[model samples]
Target: MSRWSSETSKKFILVFVFLFLLYGCATAPVTGRKQLILVDPQTEIKLGLQAYEEILKKEKLCNDPTINALVQRVGMRIAKASGKNYDWEFKVIDKPESINAFCLPGGKVFVYTGILPVAQNEAGLATVLAHEIAHAIARHGAERMSIAMVAAFGEVLAAELLDLNNSRTRELFMAAYGLGATVGLILPYSRKQEYEADTIGLYLMAKAGYDPREAIKFWERMRQAASGRRKIPEFLSTHPADGKRIQALKNLLPQVLPIYEKAEHKYGLGEKIPEPHCR
Candidate 1:
């Protein structure tokens, strides 16, 4: 009975915070999906701009003219297709060891040079850039911060209910909230966001005259590259397994393919990116 009462109290606290987040709902730009965005667009944009500045200060900008031109060409096409009048900028980071790329809110895109090998052509690069840009337009970052706040609220409630002074009890509270909220609520939400990004990215890339089918090829290459790496359990992972992601993209192709077929320029694979002797 004692344990049951405590469990019930925890549930009530989580529900309350969850409902609070729901009150600040916003719709995602491309998909029109309703999302819980605790932060306003202005605030999100401000934070993103600040973060982007900080990142630029820390990371060396790639001085390769060829790489810069390639990213700019693909990026501008996608940005125009998005139909959002964001002050957009595309840049390449000089990090050869990092396999990551991202777009900050309002369209600051930073691509790592290391990813160039994997994104062997313009279409492949389009897939990467478009997906990252999708995350920004979808306002996934705001939604994630909102969820994290709710998770933090749960921790506070647990601390009040349990004996915070006890080390064992503190451990229990931390582990329960940290692992449960992150792996349970956040991971599933992120997977959903990831799929949404893929869908929107296909549209943007196809509309930008890049081949949408190349997204699948890019992911297959990503899957192969990631094969030997240790994977987080699917239920606890933020991103879906590469195979699952590719399958979902395949299902969505019927919708995205027509957009590609009708594109005015239809630069199929566009230009082949030069093999990096930087490798």
Candidate 2:
């Protein structure tokens, strides 16, 4: 079957499922938004843990003791505040040119050294950590996998019902879910997921005693860094900076500031931020 023909059938099945929920869904934590997910959280976490281990084997870990300590410190603080019971581990990769960070399911975090300069200070790093951690806490990855699974299943059902060839349908399944064994699969979050991550991340950073304003500053620096470079690779593509993110943070500032203030009162917020030393 041609790609066009396969996609047409896939779209038709998707529309049918859209009008009727094929699977019972769950609501996102903190945001309380309904999500059409079919995958179990346990299975999702297992996939994440497996993928993270594979990634670590292919990537070199940073030898800088100071950087490693800082990542651990901030990561632990945010995890503690998130109040979600999960095993957490943090690692700093020695990639000096790749500006990226991600947190897999079950609280595993990987931060690239390339992002250190952009982060600038501990608070900046906290922002990135908090954001990625928020993704894991909210099970956004599982939700995405669930959506893909439903699409794939829909295709299979249609093929079986209509007595069509299943090979093309299988290909559509991979395309829809992006299941290639590429080195870096850049999974772009939905707009809703991005906003939820921002919101929960702000609260986490605040509870961890990091200034909420640093999150905005970190994003601004990230935007500047991206513009200074040539083009971003497809594997590293991020959401466009529409200024809405910053504006949203500003609106949420009032809610998070108090938490930051409370944490600071308990743990003195006058520690000097150290300068970054490249290895």
Candidate 3:
């Protein structure tokens, strides 16, 4: 068979698989956003649990009872509000220099000790935890994977059409595909996921009895902390800029405030999260 004909046949198969997957969609909880999801819930959960176990074995876990108790308290409250039926587990990772936190698909949450200082108190921590939980509940990673599959298939189709054989062709193909996905597809969705996580997280935190207003304060502190370092301009960055994020939170307050007001056991700005004794 001619190279052109052979490549065209394979390209047709990739297109079919791509469209088949796109047809399988799921709506995200809380936000009700229609997400293009191709992965099975059970598979995603198993992968999350596997990764959680692997990370636990590799990373230094904070054995401080006080911090663990606090993380469990905040994590459980938000998880309950999120209405996820998974076996939720929260752990404090002893990474004092890395200010980060995240939730895996099956409700495993990890908080870095570094972010604790920025969190300052229980309410601030609630903001961070809730946001991470929101991402998991929304299956943002799966949505991205779905998008990535489409992008990859498109790249394959392009490669087949070009039928280039030089080593430089490989380099150009990588550059074109990476830049295209970054600029045209993935980054925008990442920013959207952040905003959705923020919105849903605010509601969850408020419903869990932590004052939603504290989120704005936490983000203000985050902005100040980030200001000391150089940052990629907002347009080029995956996350919304500090000013924009805080404003978005402020704008959302009107919607979440009533939920906060009605919370039966409000812990507005809770107590300070004393310095990590484990570090």
My TM-score estimates for the predictions, one after another, are 0.76, 0.78, 0.79
Ranking by lDDT: 3, 1, 2
Evaluated against the true structure, the overall lDDT of model 1 is 0.73
Which runs of model 1 end up more than 4 angstroms from their true locations? 1-23, 154-189, 228-241, 277-279
As a whole number from 0 to 100, the lDDT of residue 252 in candidate 3 is 97
- Judging by TM-score against the true structure, name the best candidate: 3
Candidate with maximal lDDT: 3
Candidate 3: worst-modelled 10 consecutive residues by lDDT: 173-182
Task: Output the lDDT of residue 271, model 1.
Answer: 85
What tens digits encode model 1's per-residue C-alpha lDDT throughout 1-279?
699778976786766565556447788766789887555566557656765676788778887788888899999999998887999999898876656677877788988887787788999999989988888888777677566545665354432323324443323322222223312333234667888989899999999999999999988776665566575422224344466898999998999899999998899998888854332
Model 3 agreement with the true structure over 98-201: per-residue lDDT tens digits: 66777878898888898898899999999999987887888776666555545655344532322334333233322222222212432334668889989999
Quote the RMSD, in angstroms, for model 2. 6.2
Q: Report how far off residue 268 is in candidate 2 (Å).
A: 8.2
What TM-score would you give candidate 3 relative to the actual structure? 0.79
Cα-based lDDT for every prediction: 0.73, 0.70, 0.73
